[model samples]
Target: MNPRHTALALAVVLLVAAVAPATAAAPVDEDAVGDLTVTTAPATASAAAAAEAATASDATDSLVAESDVAVFRLNASGVPAEADDDGTLLGDELTLTLRQTASSVGVNETAKTLDASADTEGVAVRTTESAVYVAVDIATTAFQQANGTGTADAGDSFTATATVTDAVTDGENVTRTANFGVVEPSVNFVGGVDEATAGGTVEFTAATLLAPGTSLTIALAPGEGESRTTTATVGTDGRATGELSVDGFDAGEEYTVRATAEGTDLNATVTGTIQAAATETPASTPTATETAEPTGTSTSGPGFGVVAALLALLGAAAVAGRRA
Candidate 1:
């Protein structure tokens, strides 16, 4: 009764332990209900000027030149409804955190929550939690001194991370991240060519981040000689053009063409060869053909004999009438 009953009792206990819930760790079954993306576009006139004033203290005419004022758009979508089950909607209380890094370029770390009840203007949040779109018009300093390279390098970037917290189910949270870069001051040659006529003109366009009347310098430098320089004012479309006559430049000579924004470190250069003026051939003139006169015997000699015979006959008839 002692050994047999003890073995039976031990077997029963071991069987129960095997079937009991194991506390081993398992993967979390969390659904990603929101996706975030960021895009950039040029800012408006008023907004751009405001950004320029905030970044620099120069006079209106002497303000720093930038490619353009930048505006960031943050789009959050695929958000599940509040009444959806956990299988589809794993989180709630979605928050967006935008953090800017490097050079006085991007916006500071800004955080905002998503709520259907708050229909704030400028922040277009959907009533059904399906989409959330917002534009960041915060003025950013376009200070070019940070890169020291006079360009918007990798250091100027805006990183945004959207986090969805599972406040309802107390489950895991998910995140989405996106990045945008600041535009650098640049002058792009419009319809640029590798060769230019000795006396022809060259065309180019500059970025109009600055005022419309901003001045830009265009120069053409030969391998050895003084540089031909000209200035052009920036247009509303950010295009500054000037025609430099290469009259003194010889054909087949290589020269460097450069465009620089006044009062800014932004500049661009390109090489071109001086081409000779195209020569035109004169058209041929038609010649007049002369025809030779026809050679034939003169009829005047035979007509004179006929006239003399008629005259003699009339003279004889007159004499006979007079005698009668």
Candidate 2:
């Protein structure tokens, strides 16, 4: 071979080695290299799209939680106070109470009544209690209006009424009357009853308690050999008056008085006794305590020693927490 041609081929071989490695390493765009393939978007834009999808999912969950809570409240309002039971009848006040509570800690519904169960939703319920009181006015004049009642006689029929309603704001009354009925009492009087013989008037009395105009049957029982009965109405204290001849009684006979009353709104019976006056016992009353007992240094019961030890230990914790 000729020396010049051999030298030239050697130079071309070295040049090809260097240029081939450089061209292979160079970056190539797929979209530029192919007519149909496309290059992808930037990494930052793809990440933002993924984050937006997650945010939308969280927003849907938040909207479902705020709409489905149940609630209720007390029906009654302010009212005036009244007295307790006494001989005289009066209007009484009524009170209504309310308790609002959740059926479960979470996944339950809120409502007025607890009997109806709540559904299992991812929800929390809150509860509260409130109360209201209303005033009512009851009078004897109300009784006259209920029954077409004029003058009442023995064994007559009548009716009484009862009602429940809201408290009155103005001078007017508002009541939801539930019921009213009339009734009579049962009372009987017998034995020695001196009408005008003694320093004071002596009258036989029998009694019962209940609503007025209510029917009543009385059964009387006089002591030992005395038995007498009468038909009459009982007063508010459940008392009916009758008279028996005291003049003709044997010198030392036992006597008794009894009465019974029956009515729709009232029913009760009462009795009294007639006896010879006897010696009375002196009355004794309880004395008031002047000195109160000391409460210090008490050391009794099973847990007293344990409580003392606990109190001693608690002082250190309190001091440490306060200082810190």
Candidate 3:
């Protein structure tokens, strides 16, 4: 071979060797490259109840509700190679579904098809790169039915299955099952004053459908001040009344009053205002005597004593003349 041709071949071999490492570093397995996971936190009502229960030092009540039932967190390793060059996960290719496994536990089907192009507030998606994280809040009607106003227990147990699929990858879809219990207690704030004077007494009434002898925590959170917490015990009829002093709260400030069962996730809240104390005005006392004209006498003609004296003198003079 020519010397120039041999030199060119040698140069090509060296270039190939230099680039091989980078090509081999790319991830080949889909699971190794990306992952999806879901986790849950206490529902809103459940958390409130738990807070109250903690204050009361009771451990018998447990609760859950529909308003803040389940929170889901989704994390992806990076933009999967299967995603489009713009880093958008195809809606049809990527999907997440949630279903109830236990027949006794009633749950609605929650299926979401992700669209990287669509505007989803909590769902993470990128047009030029992979979305690393997304969060979803799941709402279910089952929780509402379970949170009744009766004394009976809502339900015994709950189980749910979550499945995530990536159609682009040949790897198996990921599935996870979560087990939960519907053990939160239920409480309602039935009656309370909407406003109270500073340093005055404010009373609250709550109804807990739990068994008697259960302890409850009453919390008063002012809009701008520290919170006041108190404890009460359930009566025979599941009714409890608590009192809070409005001493530290500022006048005209708004506050929220919440009642929760001890050791369970059941609670209620009401809004109220701290009113300013009223100023007392003392009654005016009457003066001893008021300056005024006499009621029966005429002021312009007053001289009765002098007139009487003159008449008496005339009468005496007339009598003396008669005698003379």
Candidate 4:
């Protein structure tokens, strides 16, 4: 071979030797050559936070719509209403309170007073020269955020009231003179019996006063194992008595009696408890009772005893006189 060809051939042989062994290494054990991978994950959960914040370059911009902010309600107090003597029962039952709150769309777009008063104002009534009172010290209020804005918290609501007055009195039209408020009354219920042949009469004691001329309806429910309801009328002194129909009671089992009034905002329904005494046995029939007859006697003094001797002597003197 020519000299130049020889040198070129040697260079080719050295290059082949350098790369041949590595190429023939049988495709390297792919299982032994592990892939380099990096992964990261959180072990402990992060603390619950009011406002979560994160500073990531690229963040997922997706939204999953759940129920829009939610709201819950609670009424710890009672409703207020006002009505007139025209057979009107004016008042409210829905309390103005909120237990939970959630986000809303746009401004608080409420139309009617009831809608606006979902958690604000409560039901109210107006009367011509009449006022209504509502008592609710048992209600609670809570704060809620609307889209993190409008807050709902407790306010001074102890003196809530409603009023009604004459719209036109003496030819003078009045605007609005009615007001309402909250009030509490001491409630009392008492009753025993009016005339109890079975157990006698039923008596009731009531404390909370209704408006003058307000008829208080009290119910006398037969105690356990009783069959009938005996009703009574409340009197001026908050007392009521009426005849009771004794039925369905065990002879020896005393009846459990109770007097209950309806519930009102002023106070919970008043109630009184009593027991029907066991059946009382009547006294034994009296025998024919005869009044004793008075004895007859002379009314003369000790002279009555001497009268017999004097009579005998008189008779002897009479005989002597006749003989002479």
Candidate 5:
């Protein structure tokens, strides 16, 4: 072969090698290169307070609200041959995207992207109307706290996508959806009797709209007597009727009644006065007795006594006339 032809053939072979990698089909066994997984925390009602507390307080033992940090974790394993052990794939670029699906603060906003590269992690936060994005160098602290102000409300919802470029193939991504709004369980009395009579029963209905089928323990505690207890179950209507005995209670006694839902932080209480029934006294009955006959006294009618006295007087007059 001529020298020029040989040189041209070598150039063609080199050019083909460079373009082959870009145009090659995706790997048949994707897992051999690596795997990516994501996890996120559930939303809670206290998210806003937690976020605010974390920002204002520097104490390590500070009370961290569950809603304050909507945590998200990215786990990667079996990285491609071209990557290092630090999870830096082809271009050393990993991205996390957060899109607001629902917001109680205002209208839904656009999606935000956070990029992590070379052992450095990214943070995208919207504290106010404006957006704030930052990149920090940390590995163990991949998910520090809830990313933004959108987590401040219980009615907020979001979708997060964690993506990596040039992993086993071109790209690999995982998604997670979460809501910030959480309904806090609560319990209260519905049309409960305010007053009860001693030695009787007091009826009441407990309501827990957010927690149906919850078991309730109802108790009536008088200030001076033993406490009475009963149990009931919350029905589909979010209510349960319960009755407690007010026996052994004194009249005019003040009592406290409580209804607590089992296995939950929900409870209600009510106060009432106890009234005792009035007592009645019976009247005494007269007894019958026999009496001895008194001198010249008769058991006959009044007219008979008068007639006998007149007859005696007439007899005495006749005797006097005869004597004269």
Candidate 6:
């Protein structure tokens, strides 16, 4: 009951407080998944009309007559870690599915099932470090439903949605949708210099509907042989200009030049004629020759001999008449 005993009891209480288990922090929410992004590749078509429609559409077109494929990517950097000591994340239990929505044009697949329990058709999933990608192939019938039975035309559009759900949590899902349409790119010859001379600078300008900053290739196909190619970048105004060297191109020949957008399926072409350079013909030098006048008299005229003989005969005749 003395001061020394009281100091010893206080030290024991402080030691116990320092060693006691710290209260656990709250568990991270399982629904805190990352963003879902949808990207598309160049679409393929079974028929010529489908390909043409795909080229005309600016929006991503995975739609084809037989099947169209859609790609979905998930970024998990924003996701939180689980509360357990293993240090795992909630993305491990995530599932993705892509479904086609009703449109004026019909499409094939209504929905793609990507859950663990189901082996749905035409759906594949690949996972990487904190990221997952889901791909689905939709049939042409799906798009045809909205676009009608015949060949698809320009301005036709199809809609699709991608959904991500957490398998372990109830009512936890995220979705993103995109609309695609048919877009046709146009190209025309903007006219180069009135005359493209041989070994001179030639420039070609074309207008397109593709987005700005897109890379494009301009191919110049002469009447014969392999074609020549030049590169041009699209301007903010949706126009691209490329320069061509007329060194190898034949002068006075017409060539068909095409400008194709690099990333998208759009191209424009024009016909142009290469002008022949003007050539000057040299003047001929005049040659000088001595032209002599007639040197002798003409023999056909009366000669001195003929005149003397005539005079002699006249004298004789006169003398004879005197004698008689």
Clashes of each: 0, 31, 8, 33, 4, 19
Q: In model 3, where do residues sit more than 4 Å from their true spots?
A: 1-185, 286-324
What local lDDT score does residue 94 receive in model 4, on the 0 to 100 scale? 22
lDDT of 6 by residue, 252-298 (tens): 78777777654344556676688887899999765554444433553
What order do you get sorting by TM-score, best first? 6, 1, 5, 3, 4, 2
Q: Can you write out model 4's per-residue Cα lDDT over 1-324, one digit (the tens) per residue?
A: 899999999999999988784431122122222211111111111111100111111111111001001111111111123222343333222222222212222255321111223223222221111111221111221233332323221221111222111221222212211112112323354443332334444444454333111234444444453344554444434344544455443334444344433332322232233444666789986555555443345525568648877888999999999999
Evaluated against the true structure, the overall lDDT of model 1 is: 0.50
What TM-score do all the candidates reach, one by one?
0.38, 0.22, 0.34, 0.28, 0.36, 0.42
Each prediction's whole-model lDDT (CA): 0.50, 0.30, 0.49, 0.30, 0.47, 0.50
**RMSD in Å for model 3:** 22.0
lDDT: worst 10-residue window of model 3: 51-60
Off by over 4 Å in 6: 1-31, 42-70, 75-103, 106-124, 128-131, 135-156, 168-171, 182-197, 201-217, 224-226, 230-243, 248-252, 259-268, 275-324
Residue 199, candidate 5: C-alpha displacement in angstroms: 1.8
Predicted structure with the largest lDDT when compared to the true one:
1
Q: What clash pairs does model 1 have?
A: none
Q: After superposition, how far is residue 120 of candidate 4 from its true place, in Å?
A: 8.1
The superposed Cα distance between candidate 5 and the true structure at residue 169, in angstroms, equals 24
Tens-digit lDDT track for model 1 on 1-324? Answer: 699999999999999999998763222223424435442223333343322333212122212233443322223333433323333221234544444454444464222222211232222222232343333332333222332313333334556565555543236665666665544556667665457887776555544444455577788888899998889887655567667777778889998888776445666888888888899999976555445443463335658768777989999999999999
The Cα error of candidate 6 at residue 176, in Å, is: 3.3
Q: Order the candidate numbers by lDDT, best to worst.
A: 1, 6, 3, 5, 4, 2
What TM-score does structure 5 among the candidates reach?
A: 0.36
- Residue-by-residue lDDT tens digits, candidate 2, 1-324: 889999999989988887774432122111211111101111112212221222111111100001111111112223322332431112333221112223211244222211111121211111111212111111111112122322222222222122112222333333321111112322334334422232222455543333222234444343455455456543434345555444433334444433433212232334443344455899976555645564566656578878988997999889999999
Using TM-score as the measure, the top candidate is: 6
Q: For residues 1-324, what per-residue lDDT tens digits would candidate 5 score against the true structure?
A: 999999999999999988785544443233332222221111221222322322211211111112223333333333233444555442343455445443432544433222333343322221211111111211122322235422322243444454434434345442322222323445677674667877887888876643333467888887866777888876646678978877777789899988765434555778989977767779966544344444566638659878888999999999999999
Better of 1 and 3 by lDDT: 1
Which 10 successive residues of model 5 have the least lDDT summed? 130-139
